[model samples]
Target chain A: MKLYSYWRSSCSWRVRIALNLKGLPYEYVPVHLVKDGGQQNSDAYRAINPMRTVPTLEVTEGGRVHRLAQSMAILEYLEERHPSPALLPAEPFLRARCRMLSEMVNSGIQPLQNLAVLQRIKAELKGDDKAWCAYWIDRGLAAFQEVALETGGTYCLGDTVSFADVFLVPQLYGARRFGVDLQPYPLLTRIEAACANLPAFQAAHADRQPDAVPA
Target chain B: MKLYSYWRSSCSWRVRIALNLKGLPYEYVPVHLVKDGGQQNSDAYRAINPMRTVPTLEVTEGGRVHRLAQSMAILEYLEERHPSPALLPAEPFLRARCRMLSEMVNSGIQPLQNLAVLQRIKAELKGDDKAWCAYWIDRGLAAFQEVALETGGTYCLGDTVSFADVFLVPQLYGARRFGVDLQPYPLLTRIEAACANLPAFQAAHADRQPDAVPA
Candidate 1:
């Protein structure tokens, strides 16, 4: 398996954490989202993922290669295929809650502040893109904190690390990048501190990636 | 089960389609997105879902009420609990593809054009929200069409009415509402036509909802 990723992409980072959690090793192929007008838009990468997004997983099984994109889809595939070290809870309702929390980050927070949308704000709308990103990030984190206060324990769901944690950790990283005031989200910060101690989350940090650039 | 939904909300419409597809009878409890300053922002509704989004599914099991939000999460829960008429493919790769297509709209399209984000664009940035939505809807639909062309046969994943189709139909409806020229996406329009003939899709149309306002 090869993961086509950008070092600082939250979506890419989520998949990286999942792969580590599942004990699945894959070759890391970096697709620079910024260099040369976003290499993800290149024809070569678009063939692998027509959406021109990062974290496209290429897997070879039974002499056939399958490429999958979208972090949630890839995470679900990983959970389905590698269920031993589960990334979701056992009970149905708990699993649904876990996914609901994950989507709060995946669909709710991340998409509005991503590179392409920010670029559009800058080019087309002539808006303060950083402020735009920060506004959405702050709003989303506050809502996430409200929900996590109910479901969280050692992690977003409970003592065990679930997909909610997988989605939350990277999004918190993004929140900080956008200068979102994390002070309001104490529960999320506490969960982040807990996840920071885990080896899987440690290995998936953006700075540790092969393509990471020094600040 | 009761669904807190708003007519013309694509996310709400997606879950409505899923519930209909699974033969699950759910009470449609409408939450108006644009009446007297948006009822989804009410204190009562926010208690049910902190995200303040529509399509919150309230389910009763063993005397415990589990209210889940996020359409993908709700769809996954329904599929897990009631697996008779499956919404996913049997093969992991195909299932992944189906989900990949769904997320193309779920995360890629819908979030960027939803009411809250559009309101932000209007109030904060003073931008032409309609043009912003049209741009994103066009781009996302193009990406969906490109990927769907590869995996589509009758539905998005080869004649099966999977989650991909469930997501696509509402998104196309949103695109038309935004005045996006659909001539470029012949394949997607064809799939829309196919899904339109189905009873589930018909039952879940925004115009057919209890709270739908006459045009």
Candidate 2:
């Protein structure tokens, strides 16, 4: 497997964490989102992922290659293909809850603040991109905190690391980068602290990636 | 089971289609998103789903009730609990493709044009909300069409009505609402026409819902 990723992309980070959690080794092929007019938009990259997004997992199975995009889709595929050391709860309802919380971050938060959207806000709308990102991040994290309060223990789903935690940790990293005040989301911060102690989460942190540069 | 939904919400409509497809009986409890300052914001509704989003599936099982939010999560749960009449492809790679296509609409298109985000664009950034919606819808749909060209057949994946089709139909409805020119996306429109012929798609149309008021 080869992962085409940008070091600081939260979506890419989510997949990195999942791969580590599943203990699946994959070659990291960086797609610089900000360098040279965003390499993700290059014709070559677009051929691999028509969406021109990062974290496209190129997998070879039975000598047939499949390149998959969309972080939630990639995560779900990982969970399905490599079920052991499960990232979701075994119970049906719990699994649903895990996915629900993950989507809270996935669809609800990340999309609004991604590079393309922010560029549109700046170039087309002439809006303050920072304020736009901060608004969505704060709103999303607050809601995530409210829901996590009911479902969380040491992790987002009661002492076990699940997809909820996978989604949350990267989003919190994004929240900080956007300068959104994380002070209001104690539950989420607590869960982040807990996840920070783990080797997988640590390994997946953006700064540790080969392509990461100094901020 | 009961579904908390608004007639025109694409996310809610996606879940409605999935429920209908699986032939699962669910009472439609409308949560008029635009009336009474959005009933989804009501304390009662927020208690059910702290994210305060529509398409919250309230289910009763073994004398316990579970309220699940996020349309994708609900669809996956329904698939897990009732595997027959599957909304996902059987093979893992195909399933991943189905989900990747679904997310092209779910997180990619829908989130950028939803009411809350549009309201923010209008109120906060003082931008033309309609233009914002059109821009995203066009960009997302173009990408969807590009990928669907490779993967789609009679449906999004070779005559099978998977989650990809469930997501695409509602989004095309939304695109037309936003005045997007659909001529460029012949492949997607073709698939939409195929999906429209299905009874499940007809039952899940926004105008067909009980809360729907004529445009």
Candidate 3:
């Protein structure tokens, strides 16, 4: 499998964590999100993912290729395609609960604070970028933190490192980048620490990636 | 089954479509989103759905209601709870594809054009509300239109009215509200037409519901 990834992309980071959790060997193809007017918009990368987003996984076997998009979709794809360490629960309601947590973060929290939206607020609206980031990030984190406390134990879902944790780790990474304080979210903080202890999440951290930028 | 709904909410419309698709009988309990400073945020509704979001499916039997938030999560919950006339496909790859298409609009397109975000843009950034709505809605619909061309035929993911169509109908309705031209995207328009012809989508439309604000 070949993953089109960026060091700083939370979506890309989520996929990386899932791959490591499943112990799947994959090659990473970096698409620099911020350099040279965004490499994702380039013709080469766009052909791979028409969505023009990082983390389009190409699953290959004897020259047969399958191009996939979206981080949550890709994570679920991996779970189905390779099912040893189950990312989702077996029971229906439990599975729904797990997916709810993931979507809450993936759709609810992440998109509002995405780089594109941030750039839009800064450039077009002449809004204070710092405050805009803080506002949305803070609101999103608060929403996730509330749910995390209810269903979370060591992980977002329970004791196991399920798919929700895969999503939460990256969301936290993005929030911290904009200086959204994590002090208020105790459950989220604990879950993050538990996730960090796992090798899967540890290896997938932005700073540890091959294309990670030096501070 | 009882659906806590509002006519104008895209999320509520999603559940309405899903229930119709499955041929399930459910009473609609109108929850006015805007009336009384939004009924969803009140302690009563919040006790039912802590997220304080529209489209909370209240299972009448046992009053053991599942407080599902996020439209996608609710749809998936319905799929699991009632499997016949399946909204999702049997194959994992196809399932992922359908989910990706649904989410492209759900997470990517819809959030930027949401009521709160639009209000924020107007009040905080002092942006031209008309231009703001036009920009995000057009861009989002165009992107979905481009991608929908690939896996689309009649319905979003083919002849069967999958979960993707359930999501698309409401989003297109929202898009049309802001005057997004659907002519340029032939596939999307065709799909929307196919969806509208179905009783499920038609019955779930904004104008058809009791809570629909008078024009």
Best model number under DockQ: 1
Tell me candidate 3's TM-score on chain B: 0.92
Q: List the residue pairs that clash in candidate 3.
A: none
lDDT of 1 at B58: 97
Model 3, span A163-184: residue lDDT tens: 8898888888777878888899
For model 2, what is the alpha-carbon lDDT of residue B110? Answer: 90
Interface RMSD of each: 0.7, 0.7, 1.6
DockQ of each two-chain model: 0.91, 0.89, 0.68
Q: Tell me the tens digit of each residue's lDDT in model 2 across A17-62.
A: 9999999999999999988999999999999998999989999989
lDDT of each: 0.92, 0.92, 0.82
TM-score of chain A of 1: 0.98
Alpha-carbon error at A214 in model 3, in Å?
A: 4.1
Model 2 chain B worst lDDT window (10 residues): B143-152
Using DockQ as the measure, what is the rank order of every candidate, best first? 1, 2, 3
